[model samples]
Each structure stands twice: as structure tokens, then as C-alpha cells.
Target: MRCWCGKGNDTSVKTVGVCVRKDRVSPASSTGVLLNNAGFDYNVTRDRQSAIIMFCHQLNLSVMINANNPDDVLSGQNVTLDSRDIYLFSPYLVTNGRFSSLTDWQQKAVKCFNKTIELGIKVACQATSNSTIAATFNMTDLFSQAWYGTAMYNFDYFQATDIDLSGMTNVVYYFPNLNMNYGTTWQTPNVQTNALSTHYYRQTDTNTLHVFGDGLAYGNGTLTQP
Candidate 1:
């Protein structure tokens, strides 16, 4: 396996060959001196198809390329490979599961996990005994609202007025509500009114310190409101 530093093989800089100058009588070929004087040299080589094949072999890697035409020759020498293009056959580091298609993998993996949870819940419900307790959890009030009340909800088919306090709870969220409801309440440290201090809040079941400003905490007995 390549070290985390990105070197193919962690080979020490041994004096492989001495560069002999015809004019120079004294041969100064010290490994430390050579390494110290080594100019800023990044692998500035654009590799063509053949060089890629050879490189893969040297690096103990397997790669595949379509070479039906005679024009398929190892060419260019750019040091870096395009992230978009993957070696068709070779399992390069980029294509090795994690970084490769991270979004797709994440979506699929989440779906798989959700499906597993659903299956587990279903199985638990079916095989429910006196000891087993099946519970359904929703993040309705636990999570923040998707849209800010100030924004308007519009689609291709239709467009409605700006988000109002019609379907929302009595408590005002981070966003402002345009249309006022009967039980419109504001949380502590309000932007406008300070008289209404008995605002509702939701606290995480596991933690009493972490409280969130919402109606669920006040309405559903999830949190203590002052």
C-alpha cells in the first residue's frame, strides 16, 4: 500500500548513478548534497496511453484502455490525471469506493440504512413480545422548517402567496410570519416584543441543556417553557 504521503514505494534516495562530467576532474557525488540541491521538480509529465500502462505496471496497478486503433500511442506528459476520467479497468485510488462517486454512494448507503431500519422495525413489530417495545419517531418538530416564512412557495403549475402563519404553530420561529394567527407567540429574546416571555421551546430527550425554540416543546410537553 502507498504511504499516506502519496509515494508509490518508500524507497530511500540511494545514489543510483553518478553523473560524470567530461571536463570536471573531481567527482562530487554525495547523496545528501544532491538531495539538498534537488531543484523544485514536480512530476510535470503528461502521460499518454502507453506510458499509463507502463506506469500502472511499475506502480503495481492494473488499468484498462480501449486500443483498437493504431493511433492509440502513449503520448502527453501532464503530471496530474483528470478527476473526471477513471481508468476503465484499473481500480485506481480515486475509483476505490470512498472518494469515487461519494454522493451516489452516500445516497444509496443512506437509503439502504433507512430500508434496514424499516425492516428492523417491521420485524420487531411482527415478532413483538411483552418485553419488546416498538416506537415510531418523527422529526417534525425536532427539525427546523424547510422554508423561511418570509419566502414564497412557487411551482411550475402554480404560485401561492408568501409563507404565512396559517398552518404553523403559535410560536414564531427564526423566520418572520406575515399573517398573524390567534395564538401567535414569540420566544425569549424576541426581536420586537419582550412582554411575552412564556415562549415554547423543544429540548432533546437525551440532553436537558440543549433547548430549541419551537412550538412542539411548549405544546407537546417535550420541553419546559418559562
Candidate 2:
């Protein structure tokens, strides 16, 4: 899937994540150059965000508009995470249990998988699972918070104040599509940003860390990077 690496000021760039939506896409930028330039072109430990920026730059990813789904983001990009990438889908998609809505046949990503069970099965089989469960746990944390916290409690009658993301752990969030004109129709909405960090001075892309202000992530102050 399409991945972005964002970390807190105190956190290092070890984990990568993705936000998924349903859509079709063809990447116009050079992924080869993105791979070539990422770690080599800049110091990931020092700048903390250069490689991610390069990824957005080369992939021509527009956080608000293009490639909104995990399937689309990963489409045609021959990359894999040693660890799994956390993918957050737009809440609107139906969970059909057929793998139809979540992923197309090309990628074959199903809705639920447990890294723990996977490891257990691998141990039982005496074979390497080649799979990691961090993504599933991370997704569970995300959905659990959003659901229990009533973040999207009343999807039809949404208010920015009702959404609470304070419970999230191990992942940083950026809601470029949080409001409607402030948000995109197929994107995130009404959910207030809890904490945001300076991962990239990026707009319309992920790995953008931090949330600011009256919890809605409003104003020019919210847009400032680092």
C-alpha cells in the first residue's frame, strides 16, 4: 500500500503508515527515484522527514485528492514493509466480508488479520510467516478510539467537538480532509485533531504529524510545519 512515515518530536522514524479510501489511480511519478533518493538523499534520523517528503514528491500524492485508498496507494508500487503499514480507511466503506470492498484481487488485503495469531501459526508450521501484525493492532487502536470515543458517533450530524482522538497510541494522525470545504467529500470530516507534530511541512499528504488549536485543527497556525 501507499505508505508515509510520520513521527513525534520525541519519536524516531521507525514505523510507516497509510490511510486508505476506495478509488482507482495510476501513479505519475518515478517510484524508482523515490526509492533511490529516500534514505540516501537525506538523513532520516536527523531531518526526520526528508525521505517521506521525497516519497510524496515522487509519487505525486495529493493527500486530499489522489490515491485515497490503501489499494490505490500500493498499486503498481513494488514495495513491502518489514513491518506492516497501518492503513486507515475512510469510515464510509461497507464491510462485506468478501474482501471485495477492502482490497481488489491484485493486492488481496483482507479486512482483519492478527499479527499474534499469524506468529503462532508460523511457529506451528515451522515456516516464516512473512507477515507482521503491527498494522492490525494499530488499526484496532485507531478504530477502537474513533468508535468508542464517539469520534464519528453521529456521522450524519457531525460536529468537530464530538470527535476525540486523544486515546490513540503508537500512531500520529493528520486530517487534511477533516472539515468539508475544509474536508473532501470522500475524505475525513468533523473529527478534531488531538495532538500533531512536525513531521513534514507537507500539505495534502500523510506523515504530516501534529494537530493544533481548538481541537478542530483549524487556522494558519495549524498549517505551520515544525
**Candidate closest to the true structure, highest TM-score:** 2
Deviation (Å) of 52 in candidate 2: 2.3
TM-score each candidate. 0.13, 0.19
lDDT (Cα atoms) of all candidates against the true structure: 0.21, 0.24
Cα misplacement distance, residue 214 of candidate 2 (Å): 35
Stretches of model 2 off by over 4 angstroms after superposition: 1-67, 92-226
Residue 40 lDDT, candidate 2, scale 0-100: 16
10 residues in a row with least lDDT, candidate 1: 121-130
Candidate 1 has an lDDT of 0.21
Give me the runs in candidate 1 sitting further than 4 Å from their true place. Answer: 3-41, 47-52, 55-60, 63-226
Candidate 1, residues 1-226: lDDT per residue as tens digits?
1101111222222211122122332234311111111111222112322233333343333322211111121122322222211111111111111112222322322332233233221100000111211121112321111111111111001111112312333332232322222122333221111133222222222211111233223211122222
